[model samples]
Target: MASTGDTVQNLPVEEAVARGGVTEIEKGARDSTDELRHYQSSDFASLRDEIHKEITSRDVLLRKLEESVTRLSEDIAPVKDYVMAEMEEEDDDASSSSSDTPEDGAPQDGDQETEEERNIRALNRCVDVMMSLTEIRENNEEKTKKVRGFYEKIYKASPLTSLMLKFLERNGGVKVIIDCDSKDISNLVRGLANLDGEKCAGTTLHKFADFFECKVYLGGEAGKYQVWEGLKWVDKYHDPEASLSQSLAQMVMYLIFKNRGFPYKCDDDQCEKLYEKIAQEALQKMTSGAYMDYLINDALSMKTPLGREVSLISVVPGMLVKHGSQGGMRTLQEQVPFLTYFFMQHVIPKMRSIIN
Candidate 1:
């Protein structure tokens, strides 16, 4: 109100009044906005720090979990390996044990049978052997008995008949006598005869020769015949180198004489008697070199009648000859066929019969 300048100043005041408190209000609002922005920035910084810490903690936890997992795997791996190895070892041991076992469940291959089982097997074998032996013996005995009975019947029926005539007639006839005491005759006869007597004789000779050949030469009940004491005396006194024919003749004569009962002729007074003087001459001839030569040629050639190809030299006789060289000449004769046959047929059979 005083001048222009004062008027300008007043105008300004008036304008300010008109805007009412707009400028002050605007400034206050601006200051408050700035303060809010600053506060918001600080809050955001705190939030970011907290988030970083949380992330760092999470990372640490993850690392620890990984380490724990690694440690657990490491611990379990050895245990797993050990368990597997143990299982493998157990399997190996079981397999080995199974392989080593025997079929009988024993641990050794040489497992033996029980004693009772062995004894049972042995007993069975013994029974089998004994049964076989018994059968053989029974058959042999039956054959022997039949042969003996047939011979005894023949001998008893006609004691005085000629052997040849007896052989020709089947019924109530004389049986051929086998002088088994004559080794030379026996050997020659046995060589010629067959077991069945088929090839030994024929119709030309009459069935007598065949029958006689079988009974005397071949194996038969002739083995059961007893040599007369007279025939034995003839054998004891016969010539060493005598022919088989001569020896056989002597045997026949002895048999005839024995049957007739050698009788001495006497006078009516009975003061003087003349006895047959045949024995002394026969005894002188037996020990000569001729008899030894005959025995060597004939007796040594005899073979077993059983059809085995064995020679007398290959048999027990040969063994006896080898061992018995030191025995006396008389002892040797006793070992010959005649004595052997007598013992084997008569003495042994009687002894066996008694025992049975």
Candidate 2:
């Protein structure tokens, strides 16, 4: 009985030890499972935080891109406007260029008529006078006496007629006067005559005598004979070297007017026409070298034909003293002022009738 009790106790002890070992193994497994579960939960939380941060950063970048697009659209608007404006300006320039015409393409409205037109008009007006003169000359061709008598009568009636006759006697007769005064009657007579005799009637000797008379007239009324004596004295003594040009000019004027009689009277139309014809003839005669030289040298050179030297210069600033010192120089200078005064006092007032 003691041996059975001992075996029974040993069996109870073995059963207790097996139970304690099983309990320890189960506790260790439970602890490992809990540790694994905790680690997994922490890893999951960290991953979630990283993903949220990435998503928020993406949202911020999208907002900035939208703002940049809006700014770019605003900047492009002005550029588009500038381009449109430049295109419009180019179109306007093109249109203006197309409408323009070159200067050489056409005549201007304000251009003047040509010289040929004026010449044609003047020629037409001259035809009638020319025809009448031709008829008179043809009719009187064979009757030298009758023609001479007719001319004499015409000469006595009009100063211009007498002048024309005188000019016709020269080689290149009665052409120069026409050239100088085709439009003026009085100038024709004035240009051809000497002071004392009619230019048309005087011979070369008479012309010289007439020049002496003119010198006397200008010299303040020395007797005619005395004047002749004085010219003879000049010929003998003072400037025997004097040119004949001045003497010739004076003779031309005198001869031109002497035969016609002073203050040539004419009220009739025939007389007027005769005067015009005579004037034209005189002009035609005087244009030659002999007549032109005589007029220019003799008439133009006569300063104080009476033999008194007249000084014409004025004392003014900037004038050279040397110019005033010479007698002829001074006289020439005075002519300008005298002419200016005369034109202002006489010519300008008479110009009303002549102005267009």
Q: Which regions of candidate 1 fall more than 4 Å away from where they truly are?
A: 1-23, 66-76, 82-86, 89-356
Candidate 2 on 1-356: residue-level lDDT in tens? 67755755445446657666444455678788888888888887888888988878756644553354335334334433433343334345443343232445454342233223332333322322322222121233443343233333322322222222223333121121111111122322333343332343211121122332332111111112111332573221111101111222223333433322211123445433433333333234433332422212233233332211000111110011112213322332232222112212222222222221
Tens-place lDDT per residue, model 1, 1-356, is: 47755644445446667867446666788899999999999999899999999889766754554454334324334433433343344345444455444556655533233323333333333233322322111245555444333333322221111121121221222223322223233432433343223344221111112223223221221211222343562222222112211222222322332221111112312211101111222123343433433233333323322111111111212222223322322333333323222222222232223222
Q: Compute each candidate's TM-score over C-alphas.
A: 0.19, 0.20
- Model 2 misplaced regions, further than 4 Å: 1-111, 114-116, 123-194, 197-201, 205-297, 300-337, 340-345, 348-356
The lDDT values for all models are: 0.31, 0.29
Per lDDT, the best of the predicted structures is: 1
